[model samples]
Target: MAEEEKPFICFKNGWNMKIEPRNRKGWLYLSLWMLALLPIVFTFTWLMNRELSTAQSAAFITGFTLVMIGWGFAMSRWMKVRSEVIDMNLMIDFMREREAQKKRGRR
Candidate 1:
């Protein structure tokens, strides 16, 4: 028998850290992110050309990650079922578990 398809708008892979679009809206959002990518890279490159310190680079990465996390939360909230959004906390927990496993393997 064929496997059933999930109704997730965005399918997030915790292990590889990729968010795949599962629906039209998800695809649209993905396209938007792609469009924004060029300017984001350009700005980062421009700033780096100005010689940002290690601390500033670290701060930028942290802020960008937080923004992505917030985007994930927003995407989760975009679709609700029985007054419930996607459980981002669970997704984050899974990602964290994967990271921990990688760290353990390295030791």
Candidate 2:
């Protein structure tokens, strides 16, 4: 039989915490992208300071610009995904609270 999936939970100050997995994933991806970009950026900067043929400089500049644009796009996507995750988590928390209130009222 398949194992039951458990909800992600965090406990602090005797209270349960609800964390959105999507937000966590988004942050993880963003961090990974940043780590991966560090070396590429350093290399680009090093190349820019060196003497190079016109074609090589142009190529480096174009590649660097494209990388920056991609980074921006990734950041924007992470923001959007994080917002959506927060909204969904809020809804889930609301429902859980409502259910808890109903159970208390029945007692």
Predicted model with the maximum lDDT: 2
Task: Tell me each candidate's TM-score.
Answer: 0.38, 0.44
**Which pairs of residues clash in candidate 1, taking residues 3 or more apart in a chain or in different chains?**
none
For model 2 the local lDDT of residue 24 reads: 57
Task: Write one digit per residue (lDDT tens) for candidate 2, span 7-99.
Answer: 222222223333333445545765776797899889999999999999999999999999899887775555444443234456678999999
The lDDT values for all models are 0.60, 0.66
**Considering only N, C-alpha and C atoms within 3 Å, which residue pairs clash in candidate 2?**
none
User: Model 1: residues >4 Å from true position, as ranges?
Assistant: 1-26, 33-42, 79-107
lDDT of 2: 0.66
For candidate 1, write residues 57-86 as lDDT tens digits. 888778767866776566555432212224
Number of the top candidate by TM-score? 2
